[model samples]
Target chain A: MAKHEHKLEIFRGYLKFKSNVQKIWGVLIFLSIVTAIEVALGILKPPILMNYFLGLKLINWIFIILTIVKAYYITWDFMHVRDEKPFLKNTIILPLLILIPFLLFILLWEGSYIFDVMLDGLKEWDFDIY
Target chain B: MQASTLTKTKQKTWGGGGVKPLDAAYGKLMMWFFIVSDALTFSGFLVAYGFSRFKNIDSWPIADEVFHHFPFLHGVDAPMYYVALMTFILIFSSVTMVLAVDAGHNNDKNRVAFYMLLTIIGGAVFVGSQAWEWKNFIKGEYGAVEIQNGEILQFYDIKKDKRIPIDDFAVLQSQERVTHDDNVGIWYQSEAKLPEITLSEVMEGFKTNSAITVRVEELNDKGQKIILSREDAENKLSSATRVVKGANLIRNEYGNPLFADFFFFITGFHGFHVFSGVVINIIIFINVLLGTYERRGHYDMVEKVGLYWHFVDLVWVFVFTFFYLV
Candidate 1:
C-alpha cells in the first residue's frame, strides 16, 4: 500500500489551508462568486456585451469562459482531481477535450448548411401542406 | 524447487499486473471511465440540439421567454432565475459530496454521514425543481395557433409588451365539440386532448380585438421575434388550422417543435442521472452509518460514489450553459 497525499493548497498556493474544512469553504466561496457573476450577466444581458464577436455575442463568450472556469474548479478542487496522479487526470480529460470540439464543429456546420437549403436555396419548394 | 517453478509460471501468466498505474483504486478508476463515457453520451445529445437550433435559428424559441416562471410568483416573469437557483443547489451538493470524501479521508465517520445527508437533500431539491419546470413547460402560459404551413403564431398586446393568453381574448363558442376518445376514434388510436379554445373561436376573437397583434416565429436583425403587420396577421390567421396550447413531443406553442423535443430528451436524461446519483448516495450513506467502511479500514466506497456525484454536477454545468445561458 502507498501513502496518499492530499493537496491542501489552492489559488496557486496563495490561499493555503492547514485543514481540509477551510479549503472546502474556500473553493465554495470561489465557485459561488463565479456563479453569481454568470447569473447577473444572464439577467442583465447588457447591450454592450450583446455586440457580436467571433460570430457570437460577447456576453455569450463570457458565459462560456466563466462556465469553463467553474468546471475546472469543480473538477480540480471539489472532485480532488488535483490530488490524482498526472496519468489519471489526463486519462479522464483528454478524450472529452478531443471529442467535444469535433462534435461541435460538425453539428454547427451541417445545421447552417441545412438552414441555407431550406430557407434560401430551395424557395420554390412549397412548405404549406396541412 | 516446486514452489520456485510455480512462482515463475505465475509471473509469466500474470505479467506482474497488480501495480496500480495511476495509484487510483480499481473502483475509482472504473467510475472515471463510466463518467467519461456518460459525458460523451450527453455531449452527443447536446450537439444534436445545437444542430436543430442552428437549422431553425430564425424561428427558434427564446429560452428567456419560455422559461420565465418562478415558484410562488404567479404571473411574474422571472427568466433564468429558478434555473440559476437549481444550478447552485447542484453545485453546492457537489461541494458537500467532496466534503464527505474529505471526511472519509480523515477517518471521520460522523462528518461523512452528515455531509452525505446534505448532498442527498440537495439532489432531491434539484430534481423536484426540474419536475416543476417540466410541468410549466408542458402547461404553457400563452397558447398559439398553428397555421397550415406548420408555423406557430403567438399573440402579444402592443401596449403591455407581454404575451396575452388566448383565454384572455378568445370568444367562447356555443357550439359543442367533443374530444376524440378511444371509443370515438379507432380503438387503438386516440387523439391528444383538444385545446380549450377552437381555431374558429380564436379567429373570431382576434378579428374583434384590434389591440392584439401576431408575433411570428421569425427573428429580425436584432434577434427578437418579428411582429407581423395587421394585414399580415389577418392573412396568416386565415390559414390557421389547429390550436396548440402547450408543448409536447410532436408540437409546441413555441416556434420550433425540435426545441421542445430536445428539451425533453436532454434534460430528462440528465434528471435521470441526478436521480440515480441520489439513490446511490443514500445507499452509501447507509453503509457509512452501518460502519461498513470503518470496519474495512478504508472508506473507498464513499470516495467512488463522490466521483459519480461530482460528475453529475459537472454535466449540469454544461447543460446550464448550453440550454439556458447560451
Candidate 2:
C-alpha cells in the first residue's frame, strides 16, 4: 500500500509543522510544558488552590485536567488518531469518553456516600471489626 | 485466471469493498482495539483506587507524603520531582519512538534503527526507576505503630516538624526477645520475622522523648493528620500493639493498608506495561536493523509498535497524576 501524506498541524491549525518529525517534536514540547506545570503545581501547592471545588481540592482538579490535556496530545499526535478517519477516531475515543467517566462517577459517588454513613452512623471503624 | 490475480493482490469486494473504512491495515486496527480494551482495564483499577481513597477519605495517606523520595537524596523531601522526571523520561521515549516511525516512512533504515535504539534505552531507564521507587516504598521511611483498634500512629518531632524513624528513639527494653523459629518452637508453629522494635519499646521511647508526639491516621478538616495533645498522645500510646516499619501486602506504616495496596497494584501494573513495551521495542529494533521492513516495501510494523508505545505513555500520564499528583 502507498503511504499517505500526514496532516501536520495541531491545536486547530494554530500550530503547523513543515514535516511529520517537526510535528512530533512540537507535540513533545507541548506535553513537556504541560507536565512541568503539573509538577510545579504539585510541589508548590499554592495556598489558593487549597480551597475545595465540588468536594475535591482545586489543585487536584487542576492536575486531573492537565493530565487529560497530556493524554490528548499523546493519543492525537503520537498515536496518529488525528490522522485517522473521523469515523474510526470517534469509534475508538467516544466509547471511552462515555464509559470511564460514568464508571468513575458511580464508584466515587457510592464511595463518598459510604463515607458519610460511616461518619454519621453509630459505630466507628477504628480498624476493628468487632 | 482473473480470480487468481485478485487473490494475489488480496483484493475483495467493497464493504468487503471500496477502501477500508478505518483506512488502516488489519494489524494496526487490532492493536487499537487491544489498546482500548486495555485502557478500560487500567481505568477499572484506578477507579477502584479512587473508591478506596474516598471511603477512607478521613485517614487516607497523601500522595506526596508517601512517594517523596529521589535516588541518593536521602533525608531530602523531594515530592513529585522524581515521578515528574520519570514522566519526562517516558514522554521523551515516546517522542523517539514516533520519530523512528517517521523515519521508517521515509525508508531511512539507519535513522529508524537509531531512534528505535534510543526508545529502547529510555524505556529501560523508566522501568529501572520504577523498580527503585518500589524498593524505597517497601523499605519505608518513618515507622508507625498499629494500635489495638487498627489505626496506625506515626511519630513526629513537634519542634523539628518532621517525622522521626522508629529506630532513632526506640530504646530497647531490658528484657531479651527471641525469634520463634521452627527449631526453637513447637514444630510447624513458627512465627514470621520479628519486628525491629516491640510495642513496649516504642511506648517506652515515647515516654522518654517529650518532644515527639503521636500523629493519628485520621485527618482534620485542613487535610492534615491530627496530632494529638501531649496528654492525649500519651493515652493513645497505651493502645500500641505492634511496630510497623515498612509497607507490605498486609501492613502499611504510611497510613491505611489500602493506600499501599493500590500504590503497588496500579504502579506495578503500569511498570509491567512499560517493561513489555521496551521488550517489544527491542524486537522491532532488531527488525529495522535487519531491513525486514525494507524488503516488505513499508514500515507499517514500526508504526504499529509506535502506536503501542504511545498508548503506554498515555496510561502513565494518568497514573502519574492519580497515583502521585492527586
Off by over 4 Å in 1: A1-3, A126-130, B1-18, B183-189
What are the lDDT scores of the predictions, listed in order? 0.87, 0.87
Give DockQ per model, in order: 0.62, 0.68
- In candidate 2, the residue pairs with backbone N, CA or C atoms under 3 Å apart (3 or more residues apart, or in different chains) clash, namely B13-B16, B13-B17, B14-B17, B14-B18
Q: Write the per-residue lDDT of candidate 1 for residues B160-277, one digit (tens) a residue.
A: 8777899999999886777767776557667777777988888888989888889999999888999987888999888899999889998999888998999999999999999999
Output per-candidate TM-scores for chain A, rounded to 2 decimals: 0.89, 0.92
Off by over 4 Å in 2: A123-130, B1-19, B183-186
Compared with the true structure, what per-residue lDDT tens digits does model 2 show for residues B1-326?
A: 11111233665422322335467776677798999999999999999999988899999887788888988888888998999999999999999999998888898999999999999999999999999999989988889998887889999888898788888888897657787778765576788888878878888888899999989988898888898888998888787789998899888899888888988999999899999999988998998888777866677789889999999999999999888888
Judging by DockQ against the true structure, name the best candidate.
2
lDDT of 1 at A87: 86
How many Å off is the CA of B106 in candidate 2?
1.0
TM-score of the first chain of model 1 = 0.89
